[model samples]
Target: MEVKSNLLIQMDILGLIQANILTPVVLFFLLGLVAARIKSDLKMPDAISEFLPIYLLAAIGLHGGLEMRNTGFDSMLIPMLTAIGLSLVFTLNHYQILRRLGKFNIFDSYALASTYGAVGAVTFSVGLSFLKNQDVASEGYLTAVLAVLEPVSFILAIFLTNLAVSKQIKSKKKSLSSDLGNNEKILGMVDQSKTNLSGVLRESITGKAIIVLLGSIIIGYAIGDKGFESISIVFDGLFTGAIAIFLLEMGIIAGQRLDDIKKVGVFLVIFSILIPTFNGIIGVFVATALGLSLGGAVMFGLLMASASFIAAPAVLRHAIPQAKPSLYITSALGVTFPYNIIILLPIMFSVSSIVHNVDGSINLFNYFGIDL
Candidate 1:
């Protein structure tokens, strides 16, 4: 019986991996990667590249809004709050690890923390697709959770960066007595470090991505069922195809950065994989404890696991100019993104399945027939 159970667990894991790998989304992504690796000339059109993300974001937000109308706000409140809490914790923890253990400078540490702490929209969309493939149901408000997680993590990271820069400037100022030239430079840095938090907050809220997503959600809610019916064909029908194309472009881009993986070092490569896995497991357990459905729990885990290549780079490039884009971008886009999509997604799904099992008697030990 024990051997049979272990075999069953292995078979289940293998089946999931096979199913995910064969999906159109993953296949397209792999095609793009191959194209890039071999130096093929395949490229997504510039116009389409710009258009796909907006369309995807709008579709997700609108669907979520419609779902929210059906589910009501009360059901979403706790989850949103939980997402915010997770964002803060993840950011702080990542900063400490990157700074202290990884021996990175403050700017690089905070930049990376922000990048990993924030959720990826594309990854979340793919996770939703995975759930749909598995015939799993999830909360519509999970879209709202994605929206909340991105900004909260970024804002906290930016604030922390500012504080660290200010302290570093003060320390430099004290050490310099007669070096007027150096003191002047330190003063300039101090001014820059005093970046307006309120301004960043406003920008984050009003950014194009946030605007499209939030606006679409509002439109969706206001429109109701009949209104959704009118536009469902475009938003719902084309979403998967759009994602496949988007990921194709993503794969090409990630492939271009493959060489950068060597530049980022083995330590960071390992860091990118391990940290997100830890965060993902925490997200899964938290979602289960909060009584989420298996699909919702998996989605939550994906969001936690995914690192923001888009939003984080945009913000951090301006806010933390000193941080190396090569480091953060390569880690998030080149390593973490692929790992989450190809490997972590199936693992999260399986883990969530066990946690949300009907009898609550199913677990790794019992499922694998481990007596200990």
Candidate 2:
């Protein structure tokens, strides 16, 4: 029976891999990779490249808002809280590991921590597509979870950056008290760091992506079912196709940066892959413990596993100016993103399947005798 169980797990994993790899979305991503590999001069237009993300985020937000209206805030409260807690914990933990274990500088540590801690919008979309392909249903309100994860991770990272700067300034001031000029400079630096937190919060909250997603969600909720129906043909109908195209562009971009992986060194390359796998497993367990269904658990796992290439870079490049872009961006886009798409998604889904039971009738909560 033990052998049979192991074999069953293997079979399940194999089935998931086959199903995921054969999807049109994955195929388009591979095509983009191929185009980039051969230097085929295949390029997405500048306008379309910019428009796709907006369309996708708006569509997801609107759909989520509609679902949120149906499900109500009470049902979503636990999940949102779970998401917030996860973001905080993940960012701090990753920062510690990068600082102590990886021996990275403080800025780089915070940047990488925030990047990996935040959720990926496109990856979440791919997970939804994967679930749909498998005939699995997840709550649409999981979009709220996605929205909550990104900014919180970044905000925490910014706060940490300011804290670190403040500490260093104090250290410098204590050492240079005899020098009035140096003391004044240090005081100015201290003031700048203190003030930067507000700017960080504003930038993070008002980011183009956040605005679009939040706006769409509000709009979606306001319109409700009847309103969604009128516009469903645009938002709902074209979502998957838009994702495919966006991924194709993503593949090309990631493909172009394939060389940077070597530049980031073997430690970070391995770090990028291994950490996310660990995060995915943890995410699955946490989501299962929270009484989420199999599909919801898998989606949550994807959120935890995904690293932010888009939003993190936009913020971190400005927020933590000292950190190298290559380390975070290359590791995310070149390594972690693809790994999550091709490999981690199936692993997460399979783990969620086991946690939720193959028949989907029981979850970890029920097995553990916990009442939800």
Candidate 3:
């Protein structure tokens, strides 16, 4: 019993670091950081840094779509909805926690919600890499789930922001007290169009990230088996090379951010770090109960545990401008993003094995509504 307990505890710690440390993308990121710190002349063109994500997203989306094309529509729908649902729940949960912390207001809460709602491409990339490293199999359509979840969570965050605004307007007129009035003024914030659900959705669907992914999927689907055979040169061949360059850029960016990470308060920082870890643990239990494969379980844990910097922050800028970017950005980029991409995934995989060992007959696919 003690050995089992100790193993569980070790798995938890390994999970935390696994999310942050083991991936190749992170290694390249570290290399970039080291190069920058040492004053090496190495630099990614700003245009390239901006454009590479587009390529990455497009590649992932296309691959997912093509895979979905093969899987047919029926098997693909459930997981997609589950991904969106999880995204919404996680976003709202994170926002409420931030609000109770009292350092951020309603607008900030919305912005923060959107941010935590979406997924990180870099982190996802690393997770996929780990799957490949372990020779594990997962549904190809998950890439589509990744794409869909990004937009849906973003919309939910905006919806919450709008709700907060309505509540404020109603509260402002009800109480005639000076303190309440003061609170109103304090809570009042500028509204950016980016915060609107419609606007955020439009941006998400048409944005460079989604566009690339969708376009690639269509192309991949159109060509089918012949396409995979032909384009294997670029898609399979240069993928690692592209990723290395991408991580090198990420490393430099992360290192730059690390320089000022101290500005974000300890409470917020701890929350950012622990929340994902907590989510991953819960995910493990859910996956175990559902009887998912270890690969699927780990990926599911990653989806639940990962937070977004791109989709959420962009929306927050318009919907909740009053929210401090430092809290979300620093937390997501500086703390959670790094931790999950580098350390958490492997640990999740290991723990998943143990969970499955005790429950050998688990089969999540046959049992619906299990909350994986």
Candidate 4:
């Protein structure tokens, strides 16, 4: 029976890859990539490129908010809080690895931390599609989990990076003060950093991304079915098309940095792949232990495994300008996103299934009042 189970898992995994890889959205993304590789004079309009990310994110938020209406907030409170806490912990875990193992400077370490910790919207879209294709049902409130997790990592990364940068500046003051003859100036600069950090914290909390996502969620929750039904078609009907446009733009952005692979080094290349897989397995365990269904378990794993190319990059660019943009963006969109959608998602689903089966046996044992 074990041998039979292993073989069936392998076959199902193969089917998942085949189905996800052949989808129109993935194909369009590939087309953009090939265009970039060939240097085909392919240029997305600057306006379109800038506009797509915001639109797609807002659309996702609105839809997620509507879903939250369909499913109330009461039952999902535990899973939502668990996801947020685990997400922040996940970010810190990677930040430490970047600082200690990779020997990255504090700014770069925190920036990479934000990138890895934040979830990918497009990746989640692909995961949702995967679940639908499999005809698996997940908790609707997983949508709220998606909206909240991105900003938690964003806020934490900014604060940590700013703290590190400020400490280093203070450490330099006594030594550099005499050489530069500017002790008073140094004190003034320190004051500026504090004010700046406060402003950044304020911006992050009320940023367009946060406002649009969280605001939509609240509105969706408050309005419930009838009110949302009035506008659901606008939000829901255009979601997939918007996601496709988003991915196409993402591929173009990623492909532009393909030349930066050497700059990213062997360490980041390996770190991006391994960390997500580890976090994803942890997510699967959390969801299952929380008693989510198989589909919800898969969504949790997928969210954990996805690296953010959008919000994380936006926040890090402003907060840690010293860190190289090409490295994080390329690593997330080019390497990590593709890896999750094609390979890791299927593997995570398989693991979730095994966990469910094992858990079932344990539940049965408890039912029978049998102890070893």
Alpha-carbon runs more than 4 Å astray in model 4: 1-10, 174-180, 186-195, 222-233, 358-372
Q: Residue 250 of model 3: what lDDT?
A: 71
Ranking by lDDT: 1, 2, 4, 3
What does candidate 2's lDDT look like per residue over 1-372, in tens digits?
334334435566768677778888998998898888888899999999999988888988997898778877676788788878987898899998999989999989999999999999988888887776766777777898888777888888888788888888888888888888768966886666443777878887788888888899999999999988888889888888888999999999988988778789888888899989999899888888877777788888888999999888888887888889989999999999988998899888878767756533455545732442
Per-residue lDDT value at 229 in model 1 = 90
Please name the candidate that would achieve the greatest TM-score relative to the true structure. 1
Cα lDDT, all candidates: 0.84, 0.84, 0.68, 0.75
* Alpha carbon deviation, residue 224, candidate 3 (Å): 2.0
TM-score of each: 0.92, 0.91, 0.81, 0.84
TM-score of 2: 0.91
lDDT of 1 at 240: 88
Model 4 lDDT-worst window of ten: 363-372
What's the true lDDT of residue 162 in model 3? 71
The superposed Cα distance between candidate 2 and the true structure at residue 23, in angstroms, equals 0.9
lDDT of 3 by residue, 205-250 (tens): 8877777776777787787766688777777666666777888987
Write out the backbone clash pairs for model 4. Answer: none
TM-score of 3: 0.81
- Please, what are the lDDT tens digits per residue for candidate 4 over residues 10-82? 5666786776678767777777777888887777788987776566566556656666666555768899889
